[model samples]
Target: MSLARRSLMEAAAARFGWRRAYGDTTQVDALLTEQTETAYSEAADHAALATAKNTDALHLQPCVLDVRGRVLGDALYLEGLLSGARARGLAPELIERLEHAVDHGHELTVLLADTVRTTTAAHATGH
Candidate 1:
């Protein structure tokens, strides 16, 4: 495993108070996959909620923008991690998952932009 990946795994273990088995590549891979999925899932849910029509988009604009920024930053970080994984010849599935997470962030950005525009228009028209 790459140093970056190993460090991330170790940090996660520390944060979660989980025991780490030294030199266990399988466990490292599993933890990476699970963490990637969980982060993506949470970002996806937040994006959906922020863009939902029933939401008070106008009132939530600041918070939504902050979340969008965070998601984009996370996607960029994942891209770096993906590069490291590729260089290290990691599993194809893990690389694919990283790509998916990055794509989701990009999509969320677009969705948030549209929602903000619609909300701005509605507010201007006194709707």
Candidate 2:
């Protein structure tokens, strides 16, 4: 996870007194695969990011991961994911930003869930 993402998760956890986020990893993995592929095909943002990553590293799988991460790293995405992660919150900004991402299967919900879980684990064990 990036430092910025970790910080965002930490901020949300502290602000909301949230516990560890839990979800079905198998489902998440499947969804991530399907949605990521879809994003790669459909989302212009993903193409641009992937191209940028390719130019940066000229690698393969890692570049794909970076593209997804970049899409999820958007402030609007993080905000929406963070808000949805908690029991009570919603970000209008995120809702507005969703026009391109969710429709394109960014799997942002799964990303948020994973990010929440990572943050929870870090806080739980003092890692």
Candidate 3:
């Protein structure tokens, strides 16, 4: 999940021209992964199936956020942490722990959602 999220962040960064201010030249590869033919095939298949079935499986409802809050495009600030890790040469174990913390934070978001008011983007924006 972290790997996939990092790729999305890279894409967003490229699209928005976010500069890589710091990072080493050395490349780190994941030593552990399933021997799949393609990384995105399963996700693609699920998305296609959901679309063909006209299901809400891939549907997204807008998150009603604070008006004053800034829109950090990446999920749970993982991208920022990843950049920091690279800049400071942090250990992989610490990065993994941080990823776990983000997962926990997402769990909290789900738990806290019921307490907050929510509406569609159209409704929230009076569109």
Once superposed on the true structure, which residue ranges of model 1 sit more than 4 Å away at CA?
Answer: 1-57
lDDT of 3 by residue, 1-127 (tens): 4867867887789899884442433332231233253556687986777567633311223222421122223335765786688689899888887777667656655543532333344346653
Q: lDDT tens digits, residues 6-99, model 1? A: 7798889899988666478887688789789889989988778757754654777677677778877887888898999999999999999988
Return the TM-score for each candidate structure. Answer: 0.56, 0.23, 0.29
Candidate 2 whole-model C-alpha lDDT, 0 to 1: 0.59
Candidate 3 lDDT trough over 10 residues, lowest sum:
62-71
Which has the higher lDDT value, candidate number 1 or candidate number 2?
1
> Which regions in candidate 3 have their CA more than 4 angstroms from the true location?
1-75, 86-89, 117-127
Residue 19 error, candidate 3, Å: 22
Per TM-score, the best of the predicted structures is 1
Candidate 2 deviant stretches above 4 angstroms = 1-22, 43-77, 80-127
Q: Residue 55, candidate 1: how far off, in angstroms?
A: 9.9
Residue pairs clashing, model 2: none
- lDDT measured at residue 46 in model 1 versus the true structure, 0 to 100: 72
Model number with the top lDDT: 1
